[model samples]
Target: MPNAANESSEGTGFQPGDGVVEEASELQEASSADRTPEEEFLAQMLAASGATNLKEAGLYDPAEVAAEEERIEEEMSPEERQAKAEHDALAAAFSMIRERSNEGKLTTPGTWAAAGIVPDHLIPVDFSDLAFDEIIAAQAASAAAKKVAEEAAQAVVADADADAVSADSSVEDVAASDSKADEAADENAPSVDEGDSLDSEIETPEWKLDDIKVLEGKQTYLYSSDYMTDTYAHWAFLAEEGDDALTLVDNAREESRLYPRPMLAASLSSKPYYWNAEQIEQAWQAVQESGSYPDINTCEASNGERYFYSTDYLSDAQAKALAEWYSVERYMNV
Candidate 1:
């Protein structure tokens, strides 16, 4: 006689894996019945969004959403496909930037482009500490990076336009077009002449500034790096070492403390720069002669140690007292 299990299986016409499928179906039903408020809301949203599987709609299921999106995109025309992809890329890039800005982590901007949001060929542009301050020369440097992203987006449009050019298009006409493009590029390109000022090319960052405004208009948003960069780059002339020194000094000055020359010297003389005392002095002298940062100056302690400060941010007497403490008194306490 056959076993009771064999008889039951035969009576139901059950196949392998059929039990698992039925169990899954029952569990899904049970989950639907027991949905929490957020899950129920997600299910309703997925239903309204025309998702094929409302049960798969949740914060944890991006792969499913992407698969659904890819399926919908497959039905669009080539032009529609390209436009949608580009739009989504820009949306992702800007959204990530805005969110990071709120959290104050927007220091290395090239990471924004490198995070797979931008086209693959342009990922190498993410290596900058862009501050975008009109108050400093780095604003022009910042624009240089922004320009690269702009050019990449524009290149896509240019390629499409090139495809539309008539096969019989004349050489002279193309040359004339090329010449005009070159002229426009030359006119807008940022100047980087040694010892020259970039004040002309500067535009007020996407927020208010304490000093000068390069471009005249209202800014609607923040770059999250603004708060941190403002203190560091406000007096920068686009020189990296000098700007970093300013950052160290300004941070100390804020708390009525003086930044030590030994610390500043050690930081600058290390690794890639290896800037010596003479170079540091020459750089400072250049800054002084330029008079762009009249408020910035140095003080010496009784021990002959030097300290930096900005008159705009610190009082002369207060800075002198702190210079002594940083040079001598702090060591005694230690």
Candidate 2:
């Protein structure tokens, strides 16, 4: 008896024989020596998907399905058709964006401690969009880093007690050690514990951070280049990704500019690379002065907290209002 299913699959670029992969592949290829691009694409895809027989696979005819879709569109009202078109466009746009985003990834050194978690390819690094994932990841990373820092500090303290090492740490002299200990304690970073003693052997399995701080308002940069030996990396630059990298700072600034919000200094203080108060102030100045972030502007709240906003995103009055709401008013109620 002749099979109708086999006959139907003849022109669909999929073959139905004994439902064997090897047989199907041969039959499908032989069916069309001069196949169109669409046919080739469909045939290759169907084969890859392990579609042996169209009848069992429940395959639909592309031409018929497309024609039906066209007919449905023709039946739709103008507004309904417009809405469908918009929805499809949005869906396609999202698909393309996600696809493009997967092409590249960001990474960081283990020495970065908790901050290392941000560029681990968990989220996209593009700054054109203000994604909540990035902000959440940053906050989580900061917290994790701070906790690890405290643990590492305590470990050093224990090691020192065990070894009977004096306060005059080999990393520096007695005076310098005391000065650094005071500086670490005085550092207004969000609960960063550098320990009572300034220890340089702050290595752990999770982190091998000798030092991430900038002394004399100039810290060592993560990336060293031949032209410049400056200790500071621009808040907007990602060392691994080159100048093309758009930082969390840039993302925050863009969010502020586009969304009419404020980026708080206290929020950014968690990053060890720019944790120093004087270094942060100087770096922020240099970043703005570089002319890349011309839209970025700084304003101080009544409580003496600093924040940045974009002129492109908000007027001075609007920026001040929001900064106050978050930095002051929000806290007052809490």
Model 1 per-residue lDDT tens digits across residues 69-133:
45556656665554554445544544564465445433234555557565442343421212232
**Candidate 2's C-alpha lDDT?**
0.48
Summarize candidate 2's per-residue lDDT along 1-334 as a digit string, tens digits. Answer: 1222233334445333223445335446655666766566657767776775443345555555566456556766665554454334323332332332233211122223233322222232321122223233444555565676787667655554443434665656766666655555445333423343323332222222222212121222222122222222344134333332134346456658656587776655553233446745765777666777777777888989888777777888988998888778998898
Clashes of each: 1, 2
Instruction: Mark the regions of model 1 whose C-alpha exceeds 4 Å error after superposition.
Output: 1-23, 26-64, 99-116, 119-222, 225-282, 288-296, 302-305, 310-318, 330-334
Candidate 2 lDDT for residue 167: 61
Off by over 4 Å in 2: 1-249, 257-259, 271-274
Provide TM-scores for the models: 0.38, 0.28
| Clash pairs for candidate 1 | 110-126
